[model samples]
Every structure is written in structure tokens, then in C-alpha cells.
Target: MKKAIGKAFLAITGWKGEGAPPEHGRYVLIAAPHTSNWDFPFTLAFAWAYGVEMRWMGKHTLFEGPKGWFFRAVGGVPVIRHERRSMVQQMVDLFTEHDRLALVVPAEGTRSLVPHWKSGFYHIARGANVPVVLGYLDYSRKTGGFGGLLEPTGDMRADMDRVRAFYADKVGKFPEKFGPIRLKEELEADEIAAAKLAS
Candidate 1:
């Protein structure tokens, strides 16, 4: 019933996806182009269509009433982002507790452009000794997809560069939704700009 409902909703909303089913593993699933609220439901529909059951984290505040019940049924887990708890430690605990689970996390962490992406996804994958699955929502093609699994090697900067390069030319149907990838030089320049502004 859940899968049928999700598929039907996607069809009605004209949401299209092109990803292969996610494999079962202890993985950090990173969804891209998270530029809108609708991405969540769209991605959920796509996941359901592929019959891939994944547990994803969201801010604790989003859980409420019947909606919360529904999200829980669909494998939603609340993450207290503001807590002092180390994200790496939390992921280690979760992966340790749940065997062979795919913990989906949004690498961008928001619908807006930032100087850089949240590194928790990288840290979680490394700490848990799992693969990182790069999931994408290319609004340009009205499509979504996932690449082959990637295992983090603890070299943060190098690993991120590899990941970014993989998706660089992957055109989306909604080009406007795609954000610019801040290159290493761009990151340093942004930091310098921020420092100047602060002074």
C-alpha cells in the first residue's frame, strides 16, 4: 500500500526518476540539488518506486502528529542537529545499532548555496566504515539517479573532489536548480572575503 501510494503520487505530480535501486549496506546516502522542500517527497517517491527501503535523518522538529507517524512508518529518524553530540559519534552509534542499514543524509544540508557542504556525511561514512552512495535529484531532466557505491578513504578534501567531479557535467532538467560547486580555490577566496567583511 505504501509503495503504491508513493508511486501513484509521483505519477500524479509528474515526478520522474532514473536511479537504480540502492543496495543494502552500511552507507551514507547523499542526495544532491536539495534546493527545495518538494525534493524530500520527490526523492521519497523515487526511493519507493525502486523498492529501496532506506532510513533517513531529518531535524527533530519536523516530526509531529499523524505526519510524524507516517514518516516513522516510512523510515524517518530524527536527528538533533543542534546537540553537542558529535555527528561522527552519532553515526557510529546508529550504524553499530543497525546492521547493514543505509542511512540517507543530505550532503548540502539546505536548499541554499553555502560556502561548502556539511562534512558529516563524509565523517559518518568513514567512522562507520561504509560506502557513500551519491544520490542526485536533477530537476532539469525531471529525473533522479544514484551512482555506484563509494567508500570513503579518510582523505576529506580528495574524496570530495572525486565526488564533485563525478557529477560535474551530469545535466539536470531544471538547470536553475543546480548550484555552483565551490572549487578549492573558490573556498579559500570565500573565506578571505568573509574575513574582510568581518573586519
Candidate 2:
């Protein structure tokens, strides 16, 4: 029923998916160019269309209300973003516990522009000893699906370069809001320097 609903949603919206979802038992799925609210529903539809039951994290508060049960039923996990807990290790432990887990993370972290992407997804995949599947939603083409997988080599710069290349051609709903996909460390220094100069 979910699969059929996903297909119908895509068909009605005039959107098509390209590649198949990951066939592996465990991996980190990172979606890019998440610049609009529409990305969420489109992503859910794409996943269901491919018969992929993916787990995604939401703020802990989202899991506290009446609709919380519905969210959990759809694979939503509560995450305490402001806590000091080691999220990467927690995710790694989840991989260890589950024989098959495909965790979906939106690297951009927000719909508005940011200087760099959050590196939590990369760390989670690396710590869990799993591949990172590149998921994309290209609004220009009305297409969305997995692109491919990346095996982290502990080389942050090179690995992120490949990620940027993969998403280079993918267009988001708000193109101006999508910045280059770079590491947080790389951009933090620039942000700090800019702040210093402004003072």
C-alpha cells in the first residue's frame, strides 16, 4: 500500500526516480541539496517507490506529541540535537545492533544556506564501517533517487571532493539556497575570520 501510494504521488506530481535504492544490508544514506520543505515528502515518496524502508532522525520533540506514533511507524527516530551525546557512536551502535539498517541523513541540515555541510553523516558511516549512499533530488529534472555509494577512505578532503562532484549537476528547488557541499571544518575557519573582520 505504501509503495502504491508512493508511485501514485510521483506520477501525480510528474516526478520520476532514476537509480534503485541501495541493496546492501547496512549503509548511511545522505541526501543533498535539501533546500525546500518539499524535499521531505519527495524523499519519502522516492524511498517508498523503491521499496526502501529507511530510518531518519527527527528532533526529540517531534516524537513527543499525538502524531509521534505515526512518525515512529514511518521509521522516524528521535534525536536530541542539543545534547552532548556522541551521535556518531550512537548511530554506529545502531548499525551493530541491527543486521539491516539504512539511515537517511540530510547533510545540509537546514533549508537555508550554510557555508558548509554537517559532517555527522560521514562520521557515522565511517564509524559504522558502512558505505555512504549518495541520494539526490533534482528539481529541474523532476527526478530523485540514489546516485551511488562511497566507501570512506579516512581522507576527508578527497572524499568530500567526490561528494561535491556528484551533486554538482543536481538542482534543488531553491538553487540559491544550496551552497557547495564542503566539510564543516573547512568552512568554520572562514566564518570565524569573517566575523573577526566585521568587528
Candidate 3:
């Protein structure tokens, strides 16, 4: 039934997935091109198609009531951002408890463009000693898949360079949009720094 629903959904909307780990240890899944809310369902469907047990963090409020049961059944972990709880700490704790887990985290934190990404995903992987897999939703290709796995070495700028290179030339399906992780202020800063060094 899961495969049927996933196939039917993909036939209509389309999806392509790759690089999904097969029963791996604790890690983080970073999905990008997050330019629309549609990304959530599409990515989730793709994950289902691939038979991956993905866990996602949602606001604490979303985990209460009948709807909460649905999310929990799907492995949703309600997070209270207002509790001053460190996301990285929570993830480390969860990973310690689970031993083997794949947690989905969106670096953009939203569909809208922002100057600098939240950077929490990077921290989580580094702190938890886990691989950070790059998952993506590319509207242009009508696909969603995981990219290369990155093992962050606590070097933020250098790691981000590799990340930007991976998503370069990717396009978003939405009008006036490119890749979700592209064209940020940090990219501009990197370019300027490189130019200065070259000069």
C-alpha cells in the first residue's frame, strides 16, 4: 500500500530519489531547494517510496491531539523551540538513545530566501559524530533525492564550499526561483574572500 500510494503520487507529481542509505547508523538528512511547502509531501513521499524510516522534527504544538498521533506514527518528534533547548543537543541526545537513526533537517528552515542558513544541521552532524547526507527537491528535474554524503570536520566555511558546489546549477520549479541554498549572502562573502586571495 505504501509503494502503491507513493507510485501513484509520483506518477502524477513525479519524484526521483537516490543515495538513500540502507540501514545506516545515526545521521542527518538535509533536503534543499526548499522554495515551497510542496517540498515536504514530495520529499516524504519519495522517502516512503525508497522504504526509508525518516524522522522529522516539528513544533511541539503540532504534536498534540489526533493529528499529533499521525505525526508520531510517522516518527515525528515534537520540538519546542521556545524552551531554549539546543537543537544540536536534542539531536545528540536522541542519537545517543537510538544508536541508529536518520533525522531529517531542512537547513533553510523555511521556503523563503534568507541571507544565511540556520547552520544547525551542520552543528548537529558535527556534534553527534554523524554523516550529513544532502537530500534535495529539484522541481526542474521533477525529482527529489539524496546527494553525496558529507562528513563535516568542524570547518564551517570549507564545508559550505563543498555544499554550494554540490547544489550549483540546480533550479527550482517555482517562478523566479533557483536552488534553495543558492544566492545567499554567505555565497557572496565566499566569492569576495576568494577574489581578495586571488588578487
The TM-scores of all predictions, comma-separated, are 0.79, 0.91, 0.84
lDDT of 1 by residue, 1-199 (tens): 6678768877897767665755555678888767778778877877777776778886677787668987787788877777888657777788999767777787767677655677777778888888888888776566676776777776666676778887786554444556665434547866899999999
In candidate 3, where is summed lDDT lowest over 10 consecutive residues? 175-184
Off by over 4 Å in 1: 64-67, 81-84, 170-199
- Candidate 2 lDDT tens digits, 1-199: 8899899999999999998876798999998789999998999898888888889988889999799999998889888777677777778888899988889999999999988899999999989999999999999999999997899998887898899889999999999999878988767766898999999
lDDT of each: 0.73, 0.90, 0.76
lDDT of 3 at 30: 84
Those runs of model 2 whose alpha carbons end farther than 4 Å from true positions after fitting are 81-84, 188-199
Models sorted by lDDT, best on top: 2, 3, 1
Q: After superposition, how far is residue 79 of candidate 2 from its true place, in Å?
A: 1.3
Best of the candidates, lDDT: 2
Query: What are the root-mean-square deviations of the candidates from the true structure over C-alphas?
Result: 4.1, 3.1, 3.6
Cα RMSD for predicted model 1? 4.1
